[model samples]
Target: MNVLWIFAHPEPRSLGGSLRDEGLSALRAQGADVRESDLYAMKWKAVVDADDFGRAASPDRLVVGATSKCAFETGELGEDIRAEHEKLAWADTVIIQFPLWWYGMPAILKGWFDRVFVKGFAYGVQRPDGRTARYGEGALAGKRAMVVLTAGAPEATIGPRGVNGDIGDLLFPLQHGTLWYAGMSVLPPLTICGADRVSPGQFEAAAAALRERLRTLAIQDPIPFRHQNGGDYDDDLVLRAELAPGRDGIGVHLDT
Candidate 1:
């Protein structure tokens, strides 16, 4: 299987980096064709600006969405973004490995999404009926995505009643809103909690868990996030009253 491993850790010797190495080794041993984007090592550009599109000469104020859409369609996107697009296109599964920062992804990774996943390529797409094709259908449909995160907090703290909140809820924006919105089937994430204090034993356990997850990456069932237009949501894109009637949070979007 073709796999794209997008790693976003600055330190090659850190826990996150160690896991990335272990995961890659396991994937290769599994006979998977793996391509990796080591963001920090590449010194990846971490901002979206006029430089992303080739048509910066236009007199119109840079409408990023429209400009990016045009650039993507006409092959005018920057080489770096195009290269990433090509890599993504070649792979059926994308493994995003990063340390969760501020309850979200690192700036470089977020910028990677901002710059690479352009409007026409990843969003601002629609179906033939003129309805939006996102949250379940879009250009990236049929692909699978998985996140491998390392968070500083203890696992218990990220549970349902923990002060830091449930890990699933914290990741909904990326898993459901972005990945699923872009039409990828998001597999359940592999999270290494209390990373700073991980013992040798803990590291071994985490590595084993990651290897198992990687081995089953292709056939594993994706997180059952409800589709935006799958009759669970209304014309306005709000979840129908009939579904999750009593719940009123991001967790309600899950097909649990």
Candidate 2:
């Protein structure tokens, strides 16, 4: 299996960093080809600007979606963004690792998606029927993605009734809205809680868990998110009334 590990953490000696190292080693040991994008080590740019589109964008007004689409189609995206795209294309599996901040991914990682997953490449794709291909069908369809996150809070505190909210719900925007929308099958995330306090024994357990997850990466079942064109939703793009009736919110989107 070919894997692309995208890591976003500022400190190499941090818990998230150590887990990343462990995860990569596990993948390599399993004979998987792996590539990494250590955002902080690379001093990755965390903002999108006119330079991303080059001459594809208008000088006076910048519409991100339209301009990015133009740039992607014309092969005018920034070199760095294009390089990441190439990596995405080459890998069958993608692993995104980071420490949860303010209940979301780090700013740099978010920026990576904003720039690298441009309209034409990730979102603005269409099918023969002229319908937008997304939420299970797009340029990155057939690939697999998984998120590995570390949190300062304890596991219980992030559970169903925890103050911090369920980890799955907290990550819905990313796991569902972005990765799944781009047509990549998303595996259940591996969340290491209580990151701020870990005993040596606890660290070993976490490492073992990560290694186990990687071992089954190729055959593991992805989260069953509903497909847009799979008849789960109506013509207006809303979930059909019969499915998950009376239920709403993020959970309703899951195929279950």
Best-fitting candidate, scored by TM-score: 2
**Model 2, range 113-182, lDDT digits (tens) per residue?**
8888877678776576788888998878889999999999999999989999999899999999999998
Q: Compared with the true structure, what per-residue lDDT tens digits does model 1 show for residues 175-251?
A: 99889998899999999999989999999999999999999998899999998878888888888888878888988
Candidate 1 residues lying further than 4 Å off, grouped into runs, are 53-74
Clash pairs, model 1 backbone:
135-181
Judged by whole-model lDDT over C-alpha atoms, candidate 1 comes out at 0.86
Using alpha carbons, what is the TM-score of model 1?
Answer: 0.92
Compute each candidate's TM-score over C-alphas. 0.92, 0.93
Every model's Cα RMSD, please?
A: 3.6, 3.7
Poorest stretch of ten by lDDT in candidate 2: 62-71
Give the distance in Å from residue 74's predicted Cα in candidate 1 to where it truly belongs. 5.3
Give per-residue lDDT, candidate 1, residue 3.
94
Which residue pairs collide, candidate 2?
Answer: none
